[model samples]
Target: MATRYTADEIVERLRSEIKDRRPLFMPNCGMGLSGKLQEKGGSDLICVSPTSWWRLRGQGSLAAFLPFSDINELVFEMAREITATVDEVPLISLSGPHNPLLGHREHLKRLWEAGISGINPFISKIYDESFCEQISNIDMGWENEVEIVKVANEMNMFSFAYAFNPEEAEILTEAGADVIASHCGATRGGLKGAKTGLSLEEAAELSQEIFDAAKKVNEDVILFAHGGPIEGPKEVEYIFQHTNAHGFTGGSAAERIPIEESIYNVTKEYKNVPME
Candidate 1:
């Protein structure tokens, strides 16, 4: 099983990496093998979420945002499977706090008991302004995500909050999120990724804006970049070069694209062998 870490411990570990100028890498994993391999590859953190479950099953990452399965339950199931393979790396769950059937505190406690060390808000960052306003009207809004982060901190669990804009970044940082990741939209590149979104330069500028907003609330808050045009090593290097982002968070870029390419190539190579 993966080793569970306290919020402070996780922060200190990442801070040490930053002190040495090493970029942090947080990858989303749906399968045990993926998490195990990522741990070996020196992943700073592993995220188990409903979106990754959909991606591993050959569905688009957005499928998780639909009203299909219970999102939090799906994360727990994936976390259990992933923890069985990971050893020392910390596991963070991308979860929704608006489950009518489950309270957020209980959900967080269960995550901790299942060997997850952290939490990140999912589904909250994917909505449009209209939808966000509608959800906020019903009290099932971004405020719940902020409350989750606040509660996670009180419980000594790490919180990695995703913010789409500077305002959201400031709110999350004020809520005591240990890490604030500027989400640029759905990642682009894989078979199921977004084909069109912000350019790399635009994404970097947006990331810097979000980071600056977060730093205003807490200058020591760790900053990360995610999604949109930032796909692989080259694009992430561009983000690092252009912004003050401390690291990156990847979903499709980490698992789905690599799986698609590697499996397809290896299968093609085997099929190309001459027959008797």
Candidate 2:
């Protein structure tokens, strides 16, 4: 039988563990599991992909990517490694394959069996039906605001924000998203004139809009802003206060610094929201 974890149980475990040991804020640190993340952040580091979105999540420094056939096996191995190094277990979030709905629901079932804290689905332009198809059983994915509300409230998970869309913020707030995130600093920007890299300023400004919109809908909805070029602790604080996101998650912001040093500085200012 599939191991079913209530949202509350997941939340409680995550909260308790993090409260004991600070949660590792993993981001687009590298291709496939990064040793840097493990070396500094420890086992709590989540490994995610798409090089665009769902960047902050982690699932330990994977020796090999999470293969659907034996995802649980991978998780067990990673858990062992993390525990060995960190000396304790912390919740890890995996950035799943492009679409959770891609394979049969069995994939999700296996993932659940692996005992992951969360899985973030990648893919742009997701609709309700297509979105529902991806996260049939899983709680979160790359969903729109309408879908975010449905997933957050019904499934009891969190989700991403529509890229720079203020309107979508309203939808996410209603969905019960504990933290609102975005991929403003991902790798795949269309490369316009000068092939400009992803901009955290754009992300920050947009996050402010999302924050204002969500507040208009409901003030309690906490925001979790992300992207690259955050620069320093002051920038993190600026974005957090400006965008109204209670937390911020983006590695490139401090890619230059030692990973642990960066996190110590960043999390000292902000925190994270639970996502799947």
Candidate 3:
């Protein structure tokens, strides 16, 4: 019922919110990254992943749903309760509605009004039986799947993804995908978004292709990569230095520890070994 808060404004105030940029710790539970952003020192912008968006939609739970189309008090509630306490920013990634046709505008609107950060809509597909790969399984090889792009452009939301094929890069750009995500590798980590396995070199090569393709179409778009077992220090370094991504995410890495300890483990030296 009230006006929404601005995501940009929140980003601007992030440093002040957390006092110091501590580890932007975002832990994912079954209920959509379960809003557990904590910090010891330094400021941080720990955000939540909208894994429940899909589940709620599938099960039809409005209460569990994020009012993404508009900003509601709940948005501020989440921001004030979580971010205010931890000194972090609340980013609601509307992941499942990656397909333009499936995106819930009303939900997105509410998020903005609540001062929740950007809407991260995406279109992801597994390498399936029809894997000849002439065109993408989802986009059908269109340069701008007019349907999805129109909504993102009209909303001015961030159109990010876990894995976007080179073929659909331009299509996504036109579709109003503000931030392109570099995610998903060969395996599924413990959770939904985490795609397991990819040596730093492999991740680097693939990420470069993504950046290069986007450049050919729209170089101005923000580049983001996420697929990783970001447990090792070298792995973190590799992700930051090699890929086009400005950030990296590791569900298993963060998921392995309890909250009380994870806050510290995030900075500690751990390794994610390949599955035997």
TM-score per candidate? 0.98, 0.52, 0.57
Where is model 2 more than 4 Å wrong at Cα?
1-6, 9-108, 123-153, 157-163, 187-202, 254-276
lDDT of each: 0.91, 0.44, 0.44
Give candidate 2's error at residue 198 in angstroms. Answer: 7.5
Residue-wise C-alpha lDDT for candidate 2, range 166-218, written one tens digit per residue: 67667666665544565454322111101225465676787787778877876
Residue 74 shift from truth in candidate 2, angstroms: 10
Q: Which prediction has the highest TM-score against the true structure?
A: 1
Report the number of clashing residue pairs per model: 0, 7, 28
Of candidate 2, the 10-residue stretch with the lowest lDDT total is 187-196
- Tell me the tens digit of each residue's lDDT in model 1 across 108-158: 999999999989877565867898899888988888999999999899999
Please tell me which predicted candidate would have the highest lDDT against the true structure: 1
- Candidate 3 local Cα displacement, residue 257, angstroms: 5.1
